[model samples]
Target chain A: MYQIQTPYLLFLGDAPDQLAAKTARGINDWRPEKVVGQMSLENCKADLGLPELGLQEAYDKGARTLVLGTANRGGVISAVWMDVLKEALHIGYDIANGLHNKVNDIVDVAGLATQLDKNIYDVRHPTEQFPIGTGEKRSGKRLLPVGTDCSCGKMYTSLALEKEMLSRGMNATFRATGQTGILVSGSGASIDAVVADFMAGAVETIAPANEDPNHWDIIEGQGSLAHPSYSGVTMALIHGGQPDAMVLCHEPTRSHMRGLPHQKVPAIKEVLSLATTLAQIVNNDAKFIGICVNTSQMVARDIEGYLKKLEDEHGLPACDPYSQGTAKIVDMVS
Target chain B: MYQIQTPYLLFLGDAPDQLAAKTARGINDWRPEKVVGQMSLENCKADLGLPELGLQEAYDKGARTLVLGTANRGGVISAVWMDVLKEALHIGYDIANGLHNKVNDIVDVAGLATQLDKNIYDVRHPTEQFPIGTGEKRSGKRLLPVGTDCSCGKMYTSLALEKEMLSRGMNATFRATGQTGILVSGSGASIDAVVADFMAGAVETIAPANEDPNHWDIIEGQGSLAHPSYSGVTMALIHGGQPDAMVLCHEPTRSHMRGLPHQKVPAIKEVLSLATTLAQIVNNDAKFIGICVNTSQMVARDIEGYLKKLEDEHGLPACDPYSQGTAKIVDMVS
Candidate 1:
C-alpha cells in the first residue's frame, strides 16, 4: 500500500491552456505526481459540486500542490479555487495575497511551518513562528469583514450571512450601499426603466443619482483619469480607502470627450504601476490592490502581464478582474 | 483611453470555523456580476506573459469550449469527454496526454486542428455549438501506435506535440522511429542534467491494485498496473502521435485507491460511484474522472447527509502540484 504524497507545486490561474503548457513543462522538467487539473466557476454551483469539494478531490488524488487559472466573473468560475485553498491550507485572504505576491520569499521550511502553525514550531521558532496575520480580526466567531467590492460597483460585506443561506442552497439578497452618480441621456422612462431593471435582481441597495457618489468620485478622482467624458454621471463607491479596489458603474464604452484617450494597454500599465508603487509604499500591509476597468479596453494579455508584472516587480498583491474570480471564490467561502 | 474590462468573483470554503457553523457555501447565491467578460486561453496567457505559448493555455483559461482532463492507458481524455457528451465543449490534458489522446482521437479531429483548434465559448452557453473538426489525415507523425504497451506495464500514445512544445517554449530533437517510451520527470538539477539523469527517473506507473479489468487497460496488451510496493518510478512516456506534444511521465497517487474503508460523500457520489462501477467493468471506455480532494476531508460534516441529502452537493476538482512558487514564474518564461 503505497501512500501517494502530494506534489510540491500548485498552479493558480484563469488560463487552462497556459496552465496545461506550464504543467507539461514542469512535468518534463520537474515531474510532479500530476502536472495539471481543471476547474471552473460554473462548476461551483451545488448541482455541479462546489469548489471546496473540487479542491479536496484533487488533494485526495495525491496533489500536494495545486494550480488555478484565472476564471471569468460572469460564469462564477475562479471563486472555486479560493474555496478549496482556504479549506486545505488554512490559508486566508491576507495569506493568499502574501503567497500570490511573494511566493518566492516563502522558503520550504516556512511553508511547512506555516502549515503546522503553533502546534509544531511554537516553541522552536518562537518570534518568527506565529501564524502570519491575515489582516483579519475575528469578530466573535465569524471571520469579520468577509466580503469585498466587485469593482463592478458591487460590494460583498458578509460571507457568514451569505454562506449561511448558500449552505442550504438558497440564494441570498446582495446589498450595494453608498452612493454613485449616473447620467442617462435617454428618455426619462428609459433611464428609470434601466435603473429599475438593474435594481430588480437580488441587489439590496440602489441609490438614485442624487445620492450616488460614484459619479463625483470618477469625475474628481482616478475615474476621471480612466475616462474623461465631458458629461454623464456614473455610480461609484469608496473601496475601504483603497481606491484601486473601488467599483465604478456605467459602461466603459461610453465616449468621454476631452477625457483621456482609451489607450487600454498603457492605462493598464499605469494602474499596475500605481499598484506596484502603492505596494512598495504600503509594504506588506497592502491587502489587495484592485483596478476596475472596462473589459473592452486592452487585450487580456496586456492585463495579465501588467498584473503579473506588478506582483513580480513590486511584491505588492493586487487583484484585477482576472484574479478576482478565484479571490472572490475564496472570500465567499472563507 | 481604452476602458479595460476584467472579470472578478469571490467564494468561501469549509474552514473549521465556517464548517463548525455549518456555513460552507458557494458564490451562486450571491448576485456578484451579471455579464462577466470572457477571453481565450491564448489571450489570457499572453496577458500573463507565458513564454513558449501553446494550446493548453487556452483550455486552462476556460477559453476552449472542449477541454479534456486526465486519462488512463489506451484512454484519451478528449475521447472520454466525448463519450460522456455527444459534442464535448473543450478537451484539456497535460502535454503528454494531449498528444497521446489527440492521436487516439485522430479520426475525429485533424492533427492540425488539435494543435491549432481554439474552442473558445461563453460559459453561459457551454454546449451551444460544437467546433468543426479538422479533417487532416494521420500522417504517421505518432511515434507510438495507439494502445502501445511498455515493458514496465503501461500504455503509450500521443497528442498535440507541436502545440505542446511551443506552449512550453522548449526545443528538442524528436525522432519518429524508436521502441522507446518518453519519461517525463524533473529533478532539482538544471536542464543540462535531465538527459544524464534520465534512467534514474524511470519508475513504474502505479494506480490502485484491483482486479477489475473493465476499469483499466493495458497499452499494447501489457498490463498497466504496477507492484503495490513500488514507491516511485523513474519515468514512463506515452507515445504522443504529434511531433510537438509528448509527455515523459506521470505519477499516480493514493487517491486512486479503490475500496478504501471510507464512506462516499454526496458531492463525489456521482463520479466516485461511476469510477467504482466502471472499474468493475472489464472494458469500460471511461478511463479517468477528475477527482480533487484536499484537506477538507477533515471536516466533520455529516458526509452521508451531505452527499445524499443535499440537492446539489459541492465537490472538489483534481490537483496540479507543479504550479507552485517560482516554478510558476519559470512557467511564464518557458
Candidate 2:
C-alpha cells in the first residue's frame, strides 16, 4: 500500500469548488494535515479552509507532491495542464496521477522528470501479476465495506474504519479499488473498468499474502447488488477481498437508488443477508460486523433516532462513521 | 425472436454425451420435434430418440440444417470437426453455429456456403445494433424469470411459462440471452460474454417495439442475485429486460448458491423482495407473479409437500413448472 507522503497541495483547476473534485475532496477529508493548502482556478475559487498559492509557491510551503486532483474524462490532460505540470516539475515536486493516462506516457514530461530525478507515481497500474482465485484460505484480517446502494458512502465508511484502527495504534491499510480511493491511497485499480473475464484475477492482485494475522486490509467496494448495471464488480470484490468481516454502508433518507428513480433502495436487512451470503461463499465464517449509515441527508435530531432505530432493529452497531466515528463499529472485529 | 427454422440434425462431435451438451439438451427437451437425429463420436453415444447417422446420411433423412450442438470453451473448433463441417456443407446443410467463432469467419467454409447457396446463421452475433437503455416505456407485457442461483432452472421456468402462454393462444415469444437459448431459438446474445458496458444494450435489442398490448415477452434470465461472480450481468438484465412482471425460479433441494458452498441459497421471500425491488426500478408496477421450483432432485412425494408449504407461505402460487406445468403460474400473469 502506498501512502500519500504528505504535505501535498490540493489542485482544483477549473473545477467547481468544494467536493466538486471528488478525488481532492476525499484526500482533504481523510487526511487534512497532509493537504498543506489549496490551489484553484480563478473563476471557480472558494474557501478550501487553506491558503491559496501557485504550484511553485505551494512547493516552497512544504508541498512535496503535485497531485492531479481532478478526474478528467479518459484522464486526458489538456495542453494547459501540461504546462502547469512542467512548471511544477521545475519546482522539484514529484507527480502523482491516478488517471488512465499515465504520467510516464507523456514523453516531454518523462524526459523532464528523468532530467530532474523526480518520480512519477502512476497509481492505478498494478506492480505485480496475480493469478485467479482458487478460493484458498490466506492469512491476515480482511475487512470490506459492502453497501446498500452505490454512493451509499462505502469509501467514507472504509476510510473511517482505517483511521479508527490507525488511531488506536493498530496496523490497518485501506486497499482502494476505485479511482478516487486509488488517488487518496496511491494504489489499487479502477475495478469496474476491468473486463468481466479477468475481474476476479485483478481483485486478487490488490490483496497480498500477509505475515501478520492481525493486519487488516479494509477494501473499498464498488456498485450495489441492487443496482442493475454495475454489480459484477461488486461480486468480484466479495470473492476477491475474502473479507473475514464486512460493514454495511447505506444512506438512511434516500428514497430512491442513486440516479435511478424507478428503482427503490434495497431493504437494509435484505442487503445485509445478500452481502453476508455472498461473502461467506469465499470465507465461510465471513460476517457483517456493523452498519455505516450516511446520514448526511438526515437532520441533526433525526440522526440519533435513525441510528438507534437501526441498532435496536438489527441488534448491531450502526452509525454515520463520518459524523459519529467508527469506534464502536470497529470494536466488532478489532 | 429468431426461432430456429427447424428439422435440423444435432451435431455433437468429440464432445461429452447427453444433456452434457447444454445447447443440444435445451433443444432436445423444449423443442424435440425439430431435431431429426444425432451424430456422436465412438466414446460417447446415446439414443436421441432418432436414428444416429453419418453427415450425408442424416441430410438424406430430410435434415436441412446442422446445428452445432456443443458450446466449446473459447469456441475453438478442432480440425476433425472442421472436416466434418466441410463435408456437411458439401451435403447441402445450412450451418447454424452458436460458438464465438463465426461460421462466416472460416474462409473455406464461408466460400463453400456462398457457392452452395447455403446460409450460415451465426446465432450469437447481433443482427442489428441496439442503443443503451433509456428506461423508456414500451407497449406489451414482458415477464422475465429471475432465479435464486445460476442454473436454478431459470431457463426452464421461462420456457414453461412461454409454453403455457402459447397453449392458451395468447401471443408470446421466448427471448434467449445465453448460448444454449441462442442455439435453441437461433437468436440472442450470450450476455455474460458481452463486454460489461453494453450488456443492457444487447438486452434492449431483443425486446424491441412490442405492438400487441396483451402480447407476452418471456425473456430467459442468467446468473443469480446471491452469486458474487455474476450479479453484474443480472443487474444489466434487470434494467434491460424492463419486464412488466417476473417469476422467481429455485432449485429447492440445492443447499447453496451454485458452485458456491460457502454461501447458502437465499430464502424465497428475500429473493422475492430482492427481485421485486430491483425490477420495480425498471417498471414500478412490476410484480412477482409466481414461483417456479426445480424439483428434479426431489422424489415424487416431497415435491407436493414443498410446493404446498411454499404456496401456503407466500400465497400467490407455486409449482414445479416442468412437472405440474406453468398453467397456474402463467394464469397469474395473463
Candidate 3:
C-alpha cells in the first residue's frame, strides 16, 4: 500500500505562542515549537546557534520539511529550508528550531525586495574578490565558476551555459544540470575550471540586465525596476510556474535615501502607483499575498500598523522591516 | 526625439472581414489579418506563408508581431507571436509579442507558461531527422551533431529533445527561448536517440527537468503516452501568468471504452464530475473554457449529446472535436 507523505509547513511570528497556536490550527496534527524571540538577523543567528544547527542535527531528529512564520518585524520576512532536514528555524532577535515535531514541507512568506527608484549606491569599489568576513571587493569572475562549491559544500554545475551567457549578455537566461554539461564543451580545461568555480560556492545575483529608463517603475513610495523588468522574479515565475502564493516587496525609494532631498515625494507617489499596478496584475486569484517596505520610506510606527494600512488601502498585507521580525523568523524556519 | 512604440496585436477568424471588424471594435484601435479560416499547426504554416514570410517582410510590411483570433473551433483557441526576426530565414516567438504593432522592450509575459498547466511541443516532428524517412535503426552515435539540419533545414535540437523527453514520461510542461540548452542523460541509448531526433531544430526546450514520478501526483483522463499530457489550459496559465482563456481535453474512462453491454447510460455523472475537477485544477480562473474528447473513446453523437446536456445543466462550455475544422486545420498547419 502506498502511503501519502505528509509535507512540513513552517511559520514565523513575533509572538511564538500565538503563531504556534495559529499554525497548529492551520495544519491539523502539528505540534508548535516554543518561541525564542530574539528578533533580528544577528541576534537570531546567535540564539539559533547557526554553525551547530547545521543539516545533520535536523536529520537526526527526524525532520523532513519546515516552514518559517516571520514575526511582525518592521517590514521584511526571511525564511530558508534544507530539503533534507525537513526542519524549520525561525529568526527574530533569537533563533528557534523544530517549529513542528516533524516538518515535511514549507509555506514561504518572505516578501520580495522592492526596487527603489534610484540607484542606492554608485561608489567606486575595488575590483578584487572579497573574503567572507572582510569588507573586501569580490571579483565577479572569481565568485562565479562553472563547478563551484555551494555554501552547503555540494558540488554543482548547470548543464546549460545560459547563466554564463546571460552574464555576458549573450542571451537572456540559462538553466542547466549535469548531463548536458558534457555535450556542450566535451570536458575542456577552461570548462572544468568554470565548473569548479561554480561548484566552489558561486553567488546567484539578479541585477538589471538592460538599461531602459522606461522600465523603471515605483512601488510603495519609491522608484524601482518594474516587476516585469526584474530578472529574478521573471525567471522564478517562468520556471516555477504560478506559485500558490507570492510575497511582494516595496522597499523605500532611492530618492528617500539618507542623503537625498525630501522634495521627491510626488515622484515617490508615482512609483507607489506602479507598485499598485503590479500588485493588481499578480493578485488575480487572491492567493495569499504580503508586502514589505523599509521604514525609512513610509515612516510607520510599527510593522503591524504598516500591514494594516496596506490591507485597508490596497487590500494587501504589508509590513516594515523595522518593527516586523516576520522575515527573520520565516527565514529561520524555512 | 524618441517616439513611443505601440504594441502590435494579431487577429484571425472564420469570417475574416466580419470578425476582424468585431475584434477591432472589441479591442479598440487594432487591425486584423484576413486569411482562409485555417488555424491548425500545419495550416498555420501555410496561412502565415512561413517560407515567404522573411525578416524583411516582417519589418517592412509591419507584420513582425501578430494576434490570432480564430473561431472557438472544437474547444481550442491559440495565439502566438513572431517575436524576433533574426533574418529572413530565422524567427523567434515570445509570449509578449501580441498582435499589436508596437512592441514593449520588456517582456510582460516572462513566466506566463506556469499558469496554464500544459506541455509545449516542438514545431518539427521526430521523423524530421531521418530525412530518408526510412525508419531504419542505426548506431545512435551516427546521428547528426547538435545543430544538424532538420526536415525544416533548421537547427532546433533542443526542441526535438524536449519532445522526446515528453514522450518518455518527462513533464516538459513549457518552454521559451534563451541563450543555452538544458540537457539530461542517464536513461539509455535508445532513449537518447529518440530525444536527439526530437530536438533537431529548436535551440532550447524550456520545461521542468524530468523528475521521478514518485514525487508527483498522477491525475487522469488527459491523454496517452503517444499524445502525452500537454494540457493547453495549464500551458496558458503558466506561460502568461494570467490567461485569457483555456481548452481542456477529457478522455472517457476505461469502462466506457470497452463498450460492455449496459442498460441506459453508465451514470456518466462521475465522468462529468471528474472533467470539471480536472478543469478547475488546471485553470483556477473561471473564464472562457471548453472540453474535448477523443472520438475513438466514445461515440461522437452520444458524447456530443451528453456534452450539450452537461453544458445546459452546468452553464459550462463543454465541446468535442468532432464537427469543427480546428483539429483538421491544426493537422494541416503542423
Candidate 4:
C-alpha cells in the first residue's frame, strides 16, 4: 500500500555476488528511465553497470528514493549500511526497503526518518487497513497466471505478458504481489504478507476498476491451489483479481511442491480446471488462455516436444515465457 | 498461541441488552465449570445469572482469567472498563479479551500485565509465527463443519458435533477459529486474524496430530468457498484441517451470500462437490458425512420437510444441529 517515489538510487550494499543484486538488476532492466544510478558500499562484489554515485550526488541527479536493491545472506540490512541509509534520508530521499529486516523497525533509523518527515517504504509489510472484498465486478480486463506449485513461474509469466502487451501497443499494466515483483514494478503490495482476512481486499485495491475498458491488468499470482501451505493466497488472488483470462504456469521438472518433499506437485490439468472454476465465481467468462511452462530444467531438445504435448493436451497456447517470448500467448488475450 | 487461563470471571461491561452478552452466554453455556462468576459495571443491563462478584472475590473463587465477554457498539474496550481490568490484573487474574479493540493495545492494562508477569490475551490477534501447512497426514480422525456462506452456523455445528461425540464417549475436541468460538472453547487460535501465509498453518496447529488414533478433532470452518469475499480462508481450512469427514452447514432460507446482495448462495450439491474436491488435496478420503441446516427462519413443519429433501438429495443425514441434535451425522463418522 506504500507508494514509492522514483527515480531510485539503487543501493547494492556489499552484496557478495551478482545474484545478490538480482533485484537491482531487475529494476534497471525493466524501468531504466526511472533508475538514476547505482550505489555500492566498499567491498561490494555486485555491479549493475551504471555510474556509481554518493547520496548527495544521486539526489542532485534527480533520485528521490534510496532503494535497498540487494539482498544479504540473511536478508537483513547490516549495521554498516545504516550510515549510508541515514545519509540518504538526510539528503531528502525516501527509502524503499525490500529486506526481511525492516528499516521501520530500527529505532534510530526510523526515528530519524520520522523527524525528517520522510517516508520509509517497507514493501514486505502492508501498513494499510484493507476492507473485506465486495466481489463487485470492476470495469476493464484482468489476466492472472495460476501455477501448479510455488516458484513455478507465475511471476515470470505475468511480467512477460505485460511486456508483450505493452510492445503490441495494448493498454496493460503489471500488478506485482511479491517483494521482487514490487521492486521491479515500482508500485504494488506484497499480498502474501497481508492479514488473512484482507488478502483479497489488497488484490482488489492494487488492481482496481480502470476507466479504460480495454486496459488489461496483468495481476501476479501467488501460491498454487494444490499447495497445502499457500493455496489460501492463490485462492484470494483468484477471487480478488476476478480474471477474465488466466494462464496456467507449470514447472515440468518439479517432482514435489516447493519446500515440502512429501507433497507432490499437482498435475497441470487439475490446477487449470480448479483455477478456472474458482475464477468463474466472480467472472463468468473466466477461462485459461494459455500455458506457460518453465522448461529450464529440461533438455533443450525436449523443451519443444513437451510444450507441443501441453498445447495438444490442454488446447491452449503453451510456451516458455523466457526463452520463447509470450507473443503467441499474447495473441490470444489481445 | 496465547493459552487463556481459566476458570474465568466473565466481564459484561455495561452491556445494553442480553444480545450484547451473547459471547459471555456462549462461554457459560459451553463451559459452565470454567465460569467463576459474572462482573458488571454500573447500569449494565445484561446478566449471565451468575452471582455478582468483585475482582478480588472472583479471584478467591478460583477465577484465573477475566474474560471481556460483552460486545459494545464499536467493539472497543471503553475507558470506564479500564479500572476493572487493572483491578483484575492486580488481583492476579489473567485477561482474555474478545473485543475488536485489543487489550494489548491499551498501554496501561498491557504494561501492568507485563509488569505483574501475567497474560492478557487479545484473542482475535495471533502472536505466533506459524509455519506453512505441510499437508502431511496426521494420526487422528478430524471432522470440519463447512458452510454455504459466512455466519451460516459452522461454529454452532462444530460445537454440536463435539458435544454429541463427547456424550457418546468418543474422544473429541472442538477447535475454534473465530472470536466467540475461542472464548467458548477456551483454547484455539483465531484463524482469520492470522497472516495470509499462515492461515492453513494456524488450523494445523490448533487441530494437530494426536497420540490417540481414534481421537476426533472437530475443526470449526470459516467462510464459504462459493462466497467470493472469503473462499481463501475456506481453502486454507480444507487443506490445513485435512478432515476425513466434513458436515456442510447452510441456511436454507437465505437467498444470497452474506453481505453481498449480488451473489446468490451456492447450491448444496455444488458446494459439497467443490468442497470434497478441494479437501481431497490434503485428505484423499475427505467426504461430506452429513448436512447441518440452520432452519431458524423456516416454519416448524417446513423444517422437517426441507431437511428430508436435503437428505434424500445428498444421501447424507440432515438436521438442525441445535434443535434436532447431530446424532445422525455423528453416527456416520462414528
Candidate 5:
C-alpha cells in the first residue's frame, strides 16, 4: 500500500550466510536495474557482487530507497543496524524493509524519517484497508501459480512466466503477493499479513481489472491448497485472482509440509485437481496449464525424466522454471 | 481472548427496530440465564420483554457486564450512549461490545475503564496471537455448521445443535467464531478478524482438543465455501476445525450469495459434496450428519414437503432447527 521509490541500495545486515540474505538475492536476481549497489556490515557473509556503497555514496548514486533485504533469526531488525538506517534516512533515502520487524514501528528511526519527510515502507505489513471480496469478475486474463506446499517456487514460476511472456512481447505483469516478491517487483501487498476477512479482497486489490483482454497478470501465489496451515491464504488468492489459468508448483524432495512434520505433502495430482476445483468456483473456465517443480534437490540426470513423467501423467507442461525457463508453459497462454 | 464476566445488562441503544437489536435478541434467546435485565435509550423501539434496569439496579441484580448489543448504521458507538457506558463502568460493570467501533479504542471510555479497573471487550477484534495451523490431528470431536451463503443460519444451527446435544446430556460446547456467537456463548474468537495466515489457527485455538473423547465442540461457521468474497475464511475454518461432523445450513429462498447479487448460490448438493470433501482433507472420517434450513420465509404447508425432498435426495436429516429442533440431527452424532 506504501509507494517505495526505486533505485534501491540493498542492505545485508550482518547476515550469517548467503541464504540469510535470500531476500536481497531475489531482488538483485530479478530486478538488477533497480539496484544502485549493495551495502553490508563487516561480518556479513552475503554478497550480491555489487560495489559496496555507504549511505551518502548510495544516495549520490541515485538510490532513492534503502532496502533491508537480509533476514536474520527471529526476523527482527537488530539494534546494531540502527545507525546505518538513520544515516540512510538523513541522506535522503526512503527505507523499504521486508523483515518482520517494521521500520515504521521503530521510534527513533521512524521519528528521524518523519522529520526528514522520508517514507518507510514495511513490505511485510499491509498498510491499506481492503474491502471484503465481492467475487465480481474483472476484465483481463490472470495466471496464478498455486503450490503443492508453502515455499515451493510459486513466485519463481510466476516471475519466470512473466519474463518469458514479456520476452515474446506478450502483455504480462508479475503480481507480487509476499514480501520477497514485493521487494523484487516493487509493488503489491503481503497477502498473508492482511486481516482474514480481506485476504481475497487484497488479492483483488493487487490484481485489478485491466483494459487489455490479452494482457496476463502473472499473480504470485502463497502457501498451498493442500497445506493445512496455510490453505486459507491460498484459497483467498485463488478466489480473488480468479485466474484463467493455474500452474501447480511443487518441491519434490520434501515428504511433508513445510513446517508441519506430521503433515504429508499432497501428491501433484491431488494439488492440481484441488486447485482446479477451487479456482473454478470463481472462474468456471479456470484450468491447469502446467506443473512447475522445484527440482533443486533432484539429481541432474533425473530432472528431465521426472518432468516427462509428470507431463505424461497430468497432461500438462512440467518443468523447473528456474532450470528450464517457463517458455514451454508460456507457449500455451501466449 | 478477553474474558467477559457474565450476567449482562443488554443495552439496545435507541434501536429503530427489532432487527437492529438482533444481537441483544440473540444473547437473550440463546443464553437468557446470563441476562440480568435490559437497558435502552429513550427512543429505543426494540424490547426483550425483560425488566428495565438502571446501571446501579442491574449491578445490584447481579449484572457484571453491560453488553452494547444493538447495531446502528456503520456500527459506530453513538456519542449519546457514552454517558451510560461510563456510568455502567463506574457502577462496576465490564463492557462487552460487538460494534465495529471498539470500546477500548475510545480514549475517554478506555481511560475511565482502566481507572475503574473494569474490562472493555471489543469482540469483533482478536487480541491474541495464533500460531499457524498444523495438520496434526488432535483429540476430541468438532462439529461445524457450514452454509450455502454468508449469514444463512450457520450460527443458529450450531447453537441449536449445542442446545439439543446438551439437553440430551451429551458432552458439547458451542464454539463461537463471530461476534454475535461470542456474545451469546461468552467465549471464542472472531475468526474473520484474525490475520489471513492465522485464520485456521484462530479456529484451532477456539475449538481446541479436549480430554473427553465424547466431547463435541460445536464450532460456528462463517461465510460460504462457494462465496467469492469469503470462501477463504470458510476454507480456514474447515481446515482448522477438522470437524468430525458437519451440517449444511442454507436459506433456500436466496438466489445469490449475501451482498453479491451477481453471484448465485451453489446448489445444496454441490455445497454438501464440497463441504464433505474439504472436511475430510484433515479428518478422513468427517461427514455431514444433517441439513439445517432457515425456513422462515417458506409457507407452513410447504415446509415439510421441502424438507422431505432434501432428506430423500441427500439421505440426511433435514430440518428447520428453530421450528422443529435439532433432535433428529443430534441423534446421528450422539
Candidate 6:
C-alpha cells in the first residue's frame, strides 16, 4: 500500500538530481513501466534522460499519479512546491510522499485532496493506533539486519536475505521500516517517523501475532546501534521485531560513522555485544547468525579479501549481501 | 513548572500504598508543606500518614490543588477517575498529572478547567515542539546516569550525584523526565512521554547551552539499553544528553531484567561496553566515570564486598548511590 497506482509521473522539482533523489531512481529501476514521464521545473536532471513536461501536460500523457520522488534531509516539502502539489491534486492526481513530513499535515493540501477525491499516501505514519508492546514472546521466525552505522546496507542485506530464502523454497517475507524499503516491498511502516513510546508497538504490528514456524519475517532495520540521532528507532526494532537471529551488516571501507567524520564505527565486538544484549531483553535466545558485508565501496579486487578478512575475524560466514548474495547468511539462521 | 502550587492533595484512588505511588511519596518527602492531605476512596494508604477526606471536604481544608501522584501502569487514568477529577476541579482545585494521558486531551475536563480558571499541569508532555538534535558539542559538563534497566536507580544516581557535587561546591542540577522526578524538581518533560522523534531534542533543551566550565548538568536517564519496552528512551537520552561522562547504575541483587524474569541482567563488562559505545555515538570523547550501584536489596554484610568486587572487575570506583554515596562518582566527573 506504499505506492500509488501505475502510470505514475516522477517529480524531482527544481533541485539537482542527487542521492536525495534515490526514491525516484529506485522506482525507475524497479518499476519503470509504471512511470509515465519525469517532470522537472529546472533543467532536466542529467542522468534521468526521460523527457520532462509540466504537471498538466504530463497528466494528459497517461500519468494517473504524481510521486514525490526525492528524499529531503529533514523530510519536509519546500513551500515553493505547494503550487505544483495543489495543481496536481486539482487535476485528479493522487499524491504519494515518503518523508518524515506527512502531506496530510499540511492543512490546505489535505483539504483539497479530500475534496477532489485524490488520496494522499503518507508512507511513514502508522495507520492504526497500536497497543503498547507486552514483551510477550510470540511464535515465529524473524531475522533482523543489524548494522554498524546508518546506511551501512541494512536494507540491502535484508532484501538479499529474503531473496535467498525464497530461492531455497522457504516462506519468507520482507518487513520494511524505511521509505525506500516500503516502496520496494509495497507495505511497511516508517519506524523512525513513529512516536517514541509506540515505536516498539508499531514494529510488533507489521507481522502476524501468532506463531508460524514455516514463515520467516525478514525485518529491515533503520539507522544503527551506532547512529546517534536515530538509534532509538534501531532499539525499538530490535525489541519489537524480537528476531530469532540477526545478520551483522557492515561497510568495510568506512572508517568513521556515516555522515559523521568525528565519530568512528564501534568495534565489531562492541556493536555485536550491544545489539545482542538489547535483543536478548525480549528473546533470551536471540543470536547473531552471520555477517553481511557492504563491500561495494571497495574495488572488486579487494572486496573478496575484505569479506574473507571479516569472516576470519568474526568466526562467521561473511559476504557482500548484494554482489555475493545472502545464501551464506541465510544458511546460518535457525 | 511541573508541580501545582502549594496546598495540594494527593489522589491515589483505590491503588494501595506501594512503590508505584512513588510520586505521592516523593512530593510528601520533598515538599511536605505543599501536600495538604491524601485522598483515597479505599482504605487510607497508611504510609502517607496524612488526613483523609472527600473532594469538597479536602478543598475546604486549604487543599487548593489535586496532585495525581500514583504512576499508573501504561500511564492511563481510568474513566471512573474522571468524574472525581472534574468534581475536584469544579470545587476550585487545580490539577497536576504526570502521565502519558494528557488532561488537556480530555475535552470536557479541559473545557471545565478553562472556565473555572483551574490550571491543569500535564507534566509529561513537552511544553513546546523541539527541533531535531544537532549532536553538536555544547558548553558545560554533563554526567548521565545509565541503568541496567528501568527503575534500576537512574533517578537515585542522578539525584545523589547532584547532591554530592553540590556538597563539594560544584554547581549541579537534576533534570527530570518522569513523573516522580518532575514532581520533585518542579520541571522537566518526561522523555518517554515525548513523541519518539523529539526525545533527544527534548533532552538537549533540558540543559543550558552556554559554556560554563564550572556548572554541571546531571541528566537523568530513563528506561535502559537492555529494557525491551523502553530502550528507545534510553537511546534518545544517551544521544541527546551528549554527556561528557556517564555512571553505570545497577541493582546487583536483581538476577533478571526489571519486570522481565526471562531476561538476565547484562554482565558488568557487557553493560559497560554497550553504554560507552552508545554514548560515544554523540560525543566521541564520552566515557564512563564510575559505577553507581543500587544495593537496596543487598544484605548489609554483602554491600562492601560487592562494591569492592565491582570496582575491581570494572576498573572504576563503585558505590550504592543511596546507602553509600555518589561522592566517588562525582569526583571522577569534570
Q: Per-residue lDDT tens digits of candidate 6, residues B4-70?
A: 4668788877565576677788778656777778887554343577887788888888888788887
Q: Give the 10-residue window scoring lowest on summed lDDT in candidate 6 chain A.
A: A41-50
Candidate 1: tens digits of C-alpha lDDT, residues B220-243: 111111111010011111211111
- Sorted into a CAPRI-style docking class, model 2 comes out as incorrect
B1-334, model 3: which lDDT tens digit per residue? 0111212222332322344333323222111232112122323321332223333444344432332332333333323332321121133222211122222222333223233321121211111221101111111111111100001110122233223334456443223221111101101111111221121111111112124422111111111101101111121212212121223344443432112122111233432332232223222331323334333456656876877775676455554443331232122112
Model 4 B-chain TM: 0.96
Best by TM-score: 5
lDDT of 1 by residue, A1-334 (tens): 0111234223333433343233223222222223334343342221111133245565555545443223223433334444544454542111111111222233542464366551111110111111111111111111111111112222221222333335555433222221111100000111111111121110111211223222111111212112211000011111111122222211233342122232221233443333322222212232332333333355766765655564565454334332243243233223
The clash count for each model shown is 153, 4, 136, 0, 0, 3
Considering every candidate listed, which one attains the maximal DockQ? 5
After superposing candidate 5, which stretches have Cα over 4 Å from the reference? A73-75, B73-75
Deviation of model 5 at B206, angstroms: 1.1
Model 2 lDDT per residue over A1-334, tens place = 4555567887776664455577777888887878878777656544556688898788888998887776653447777778877888898888887666888889999899999998777765544444444445678889999888889899999999999999998889888888778777767776765544445666766776578989998899887766655655677788778899889999877888777786677889888887786677568889988999988887888888888899999988998899889999888876
Looking at candidate 5 chain B, the ten consecutive residues that score lowest on lDDT are: B71-80
* lDDT (Cα) of model 5: 0.90
Please give the TM-score that candidate 3 achieves against the real structure.
0.22
Q: What C-alpha lDDT do the candidate models reach, one value each?
A: 0.23, 0.77, 0.24, 0.89, 0.90, 0.79
4 or 5, greater by TM-score = 5
What is the docking quality class of candidate 5?
A: high
Give TM-scores of the second chain, every candidate: 0.20, 0.90, 0.24, 0.96, 0.98, 0.86
- Per-residue CA lDDT of model 4 for B1-334, tens digit only, reads 5567889999999999999999999888888988989999888999989999888888888999999989865666677898888888888988888888888999989999999999988888878888878889999999998898998889889999999999999999999998889988877888888999889899999999999999999998999998888888999999999999999999988878999998888888988988898999888899999999998888888988888899999999999998889999999977
Residue B194 lDDT, candidate 1, scale 0-100: 16
Give lDDT: candidate 4, residue A258.
91
- Compute each candidate's TM-score over C-alphas: 0.16, 0.72, 0.22, 0.95, 0.98, 0.81
Model 6 pairs in collision: A139-A211, A195-B196, A196-B196
Worst 10 residues of 1 chain A by lDDT: A181-190
